[model samples]
Target: MLVSEVPFHYKRPDTIVYRCIETPRNRWKTKPTVADTILVVEVVSPTTVTADTIDKRSEYARYGIQHYWIVRMANDDGPAVSIEMLTLNSEGRYVSNGFRNRTDDYAAATDTLTPFPVLLTWEQLDEGID
Candidate 1:
């Protein structure tokens, strides 16, 4: 299951991928530890670039989150954004899987690297925004 802005210890990531039973509790009362999370995604903004790319990257790796994805929204009118995939190594550090950017070739932007492969277009990302 996927949840957004869920608490993981003291940090609340933009998105989280976790395993949940069909009949999960009406609400999860406690924070999920690293063991409960499969992946965490952080959407980068101008003010949070350092925190997302460096600080949170280290913190999430230290916590042993299986996967960490850093998303950078593009300012131009080409494609929506780019994603950097990081996987934890045996040494308890994150190694780059690769960076995926949506180019003119829409088919090439497919998310085959992540556990969840749903494609998100710029329109879907901009929904409900001011």
Candidate 2:
């Protein structure tokens, strides 16, 4: 499935999450469950700072999302992508895998990895809507 800003959940109906689904299935007719998601990426915003860092972190773990990625754009001092990767542990909680921040080469860092190759760069993500 190739969609943007779509809702996903089973038990929690009131809360809706929109992720950059790396590989959504073609037959999906409803919201994606954790099983349906191989990888999840969230672009952090001012309004969602807490939600992305705290609330959603725990929620996705509870929902059994295997891999979670948070992308934060750099401010005035630099133009870069800050990526935080989390892997779900056996205890159903997330443990930090590390980050690809301003000084790191975004593409080289995430291009080759397990579950899914992110294959993303700060420039592509920062491109203005045409």
Candidate 3:
């Protein structure tokens, strides 16, 4: 299951992926904590580069969220966006796994280590945005 803008341990991530069983039941009505999260994604805006790239990166890693993705919007150069995929290493730090740009013909997939593979494309992400 995926949720958007839901609070976790400290801050609300842009999006989060978790097993349906791990999420709170409807009546309990609570958000998943960092421990329940399998993946967390942050969309980077001009003002959020540092917070998403550095601050939250370390925070999520420390909290043991296994996967993190950073989505960067298009700049003056073009309408192309990019997604940077990261995985937690044995040292409890995030390492770059893959990066996909809008101009690329192929979508990016999560590695086999993840519970399931997710296919991401810039078009899918940029939909509904101005």
Using TM-score, give the best candidate's number. 3
TM-score of each: 0.70, 0.64, 0.74
Which pairs clash inside model 1? none
List, residue by residue over 1-130, the lDDT tens digit for candidate 1: 2233355235579898866544444465444545678889898888888999999898888777879988777653233477788889999998887676665455443355466675665456656354
**Candidate 2, residue 25: CA error in Å?**
12
TM-score of 2: 0.64
Cα RMSDs, all models: 5.1, 6.9, 5.0
Candidate 2 lDDT over 26-124, as tens digits, reads 665455555556566766777778887888788778767777787775552234368788889999998887677757554543554645555766666
**Candidate 2 or 1, higher TM-score:** 1
Error of 3 at 34 (Å): 1.1
- Identify the superior model by lDDT, candidate 1 or candidate 2: 1
Assess candidate 1 and give its TM-score to the true structure. Answer: 0.70
